[model samples]
Target chain A: MSIETDIKQKKFRSPYQRLALNLIYTSNWIQYQQVDGFREHDITSQQYNVLRILRGQYPSPIKVSDIAERMLDKNSNTSRLIDKLLAKKLVDRKSCPNDRRAVDVVITEAGLELLKKLDPVVDEWDNNMNAITHEEADLISSLLDKIRESKNNN
Target chain B: MSIETDIKQKKFRSPYQRLALNLIYTSNWIQYQQVDGFREHDITSQQYNVLRILRGQYPSPIKVSDIAERMLDKNSNTSRLIDKLLAKKLVDRKSCPNDRRAVDVVITEAGLELLKKLDPVVDEWDNNMNAITHEEADLISSLLDKIRESKNNN
Candidate 1:
């Protein structure tokens, strides 16, 4: 199950190239695995991410910009995502009392309920990582952290 | 920076959860790094991936479905992506001679030229991985492969 075989490519120009492709491909693979579970609950992973962020804040609402900053996929249109969640009545958007020009977004009761249902789905996903040991997971996480170290400085 | 600081979160439920988030976040981080370069050439990363797939099959045409199978991002609408590339004149689409019902796709001369210009951008990205050693890259690539091993079985 090497990347070469998975992608049907015979070789890479370098290890870094292979690693680069591996990271993107594996990330997509993980997301695809969750698609069915997320679709069952009628939410895309990004929307689920938004709901989770709001749930984390609970009673306190956060600005759309802050949600965008924390989103795993930075390119997602935060405002548009909020609009969709609002349409579904899973989230509430209101003018910020502290900053009238800004908007505050909070998860509604339905959103929290949806996440409560989704908790096991996510837990199953985490459990699947049991294929790799805890020490390995820690090592991989640290390596990923190191990979992003240089980018943070810039 | 650690995933915690990067996402502005203070905790993860477990190491596996941390690893999962790290994988997605780092992958997106890598992609965002390439956006500006791809944008300069008027293509999204998914489009870039399509062009590369076509380039790999150069001197021969491929079917849209085949392109989808080879794509890194499984959720990308391959046909729509080809339509965009077609509009931009970066690729050519024609009816298959053998299977009239199937459409064939090939990278145009313009597409090849665009990739040539993008070579440096991609090279710079590979170079940035100097933050991690070649050994670390290899290790990560293997770990990712291991992570997907279970998924491939299903």
Candidate 2:
């Protein structure tokens, strides 16, 4: 659906305004799919993301800051999110040998198993999102990067 | 910057995955700017959005459900968001004369003044996002809408 129909708004101040709204709205729409997929696993989408990041470095423990740096949502508190994983026993945390000030996080076997189950589901979601072709996806990705070109930190 | 550098990921399963990740990351980037702007005004972005929707219907009253329908984030609690606006005296709330069970919300002059103050700041942010040309913005918007085409609802 068009953003105008989605938001029930007839006009935008400029193309920039429409693009801005579309970005946020589209993100929310995609996020809902992720959130729903993880609901059955008793984890928030952020938690699922954290688990996947940890699984990516399964054999080696990762520093909390390093995890935060790689997160899609950079604002999440790694320590707090790790704490949730710890409570669920899906991840193990330990003092870093290299830096005592830092914590080393490793995904537990349970986390790996959970992700193993979720992998196919995630693949299916991505397949559904293939409504647009690879060329279109590449074009969109390039344009999005261009959209953030003016920002210093992005 | 490319999504790879932004998230420090070496590879994606497919172009679709890259586009999905890029959509979310860029939204977070844009939302942070909105959050910061509304922060100085002592309202969250969602609250700012609600106030703007109300102001757009200045002379008339709208229902809580109506406001939710127009919100960028569909999960926002309309009554709760309206309560925050009411606390600041930016809006007025009362029982709807047409439907005694429904509440009517109207933006006060204060809300209009607040939006006036915010208008220029929003414009500047949109201007900052003009890293792409108007044609690029239009293309991105259309592509984003196409990305959601496979879904039954967006």
Candidate 3:
């Protein structure tokens, strides 16, 4: 559905405004779809993101700051997210060997296992994009990249 | 910057995965831009969204459930958001006359003024999209609509 119909708004101030709202609305729509699957595993989308990052660097721990930098949500409280993941035994933290003041985080075996279980859910999410062709996916990705170009220059 | 450069990751499982990540990352980028402006007014983005929804129905009140339905984030605690906005004197809430079981919410004069102040910030956001042509904006919006079509059907 178009954003206007989905939100029940009749109009937008401009095409840029419509694009802005559509991007946000669509992002939220995607998150909502993932939340149910993440909730089933007692984790959040942010936590799932964290685990995936750690998995990408498996066997090599990453610093909290690095994790924050890689996170999709720039505002997420990395320390707090780490604390929750720790409680869940899905991740482990250790003092950085070279940097005394820094802590390194790594996904535990359980974390990897959990992500393995979530593979199908994540796959289902990716499959949903099949509604748009590969060319369309590439176009959307580049357009999104272009949208951020102005910000990147600043 | 490409999504890989932004996140410092070199690989994605597929183009669809890359597009999904880019969509989410770009959305967060837009939100972070808005957060600074909204923060100055002491309102979270979700609260700002709620206020905008109420403004659309100014001079008339809306039910909490209706506000929830219109919200970008489906998981937002609408009643609690209204409570905070009420405490800040940005909105007024009362029991519904037609349906005693439902509560109605409306933007206060203060709320309208707050949104007025936020207009420039929102405009600046829209201006940022000028990096992309009007045609590009239209294409992106339609592509996003296509992306959501699969979910909407279910």
Candidate 4:
């Protein structure tokens, strides 16, 4: 799965260039797999992420802003995802007890049950990350953090 | 910039889970920066990628599917992106000589010139990938390849 072999591109300006492209490509590759698994349960990754976050704070409602902050895709439309989940009856929405315009969101029992069924598939994909050793996984994550630490050129 | 601090989350089921999320998150972060730079030049990443691909095939007309196959994001609507670049007068599209319905696509002078201007910014981003050593870039790319080599559970 070298970038060349994976994408069928024969040349890159440099290893760094290939790595930059490969990082984006591989992430999309991994994403499609996760999307396929999540699709079986009728949810997008964003919705599943929100559901999981709510479940983590189970029995205690969390603010929509809090969920947005914790999401992997910071630009994801939290309200849209929430609306979808609510339509599916997988999540609950209610006016905050303390603030009229604020909302308290939580995973419904159905959402928890859905995730319980999805746990094995999700767990399997997580295990697939072992395609590289634990040490390599740690190394990749650290390197990615370093990549982001580079000053924003804007 | 550690995962915990970046995402403000204290727990991950394992390093692999963190790596999976980090891969996608960092890719998105890098993309935004690239998008910002490309925007300064009046192009999106997808358009830039198309231009680069067309430049690679300079002096030769390429089919739309060929461009699609070479794209980093396989799901990109290359025809649509081509439409945008075409509207900007950056790419030339014509009916393939041999096939009436098939179109031949090539980067116009304007497109190549645009890329020439973007080269410095793109190069800077590639250099930014050097936030890690060349050895680390290779390592991360190889590890990412391995990450995708895992069996598709479906």
Highest DockQ: give the candidate number: 2
**lDDT per residue (tens digit) for residues A36-87 in model 1:** 7799778999999999889889999999999998888888999999999999
Docking class of 4: medium
Which CAPRI tier for candidate 3? Answer: medium
Candidate 1 CAPRI classification by DockQ: medium
Name the lDDT value of residue B78 in candidate 2: 85
Instruction: Give the poorly placed runs of model 4, Cα more than 4 Å off.
Output: A99-101, A152-154, B99-101, B152-154
Give the clash total for candidate 3: 0
Pick the TM-score winner: 2
TM-score of chain B of each: 0.94, 0.95, 0.95, 0.93
Give all candidates' CA lDDT scores. 0.87, 0.88, 0.89, 0.86
Model 2: per-residue Cα lDDT over B61-85, one tens digit each:
9999889999989998888888899
**What are the per-residue Cα lDDT tens digits for candidate 4 across A32-68?**
8888878867899889889888988999998888899
State every prediction's TM-score relative to the real structure: 0.89, 0.95, 0.91, 0.93
Model 2 C-alpha lDDT per residue in residues A62-123, reported as the tens digit of each score:
99999999999999987888899899999999999988999899999998999899989888
- Candidate order by lDDT, highest to lowest? 3, 2, 1, 4
DockQ versus reference, model 4: 0.76
Off by over 4 Å in 3: none
Q: Any idea what lDDT model 1 has?
A: 0.87
Residue range B76-112, candidate 3, lDDT tens digits: 8998999999999999999999999999998999999
TM-score of chain B of 1: 0.94
Predicted complexes: DockQ each: 0.70, 0.80, 0.73, 0.76
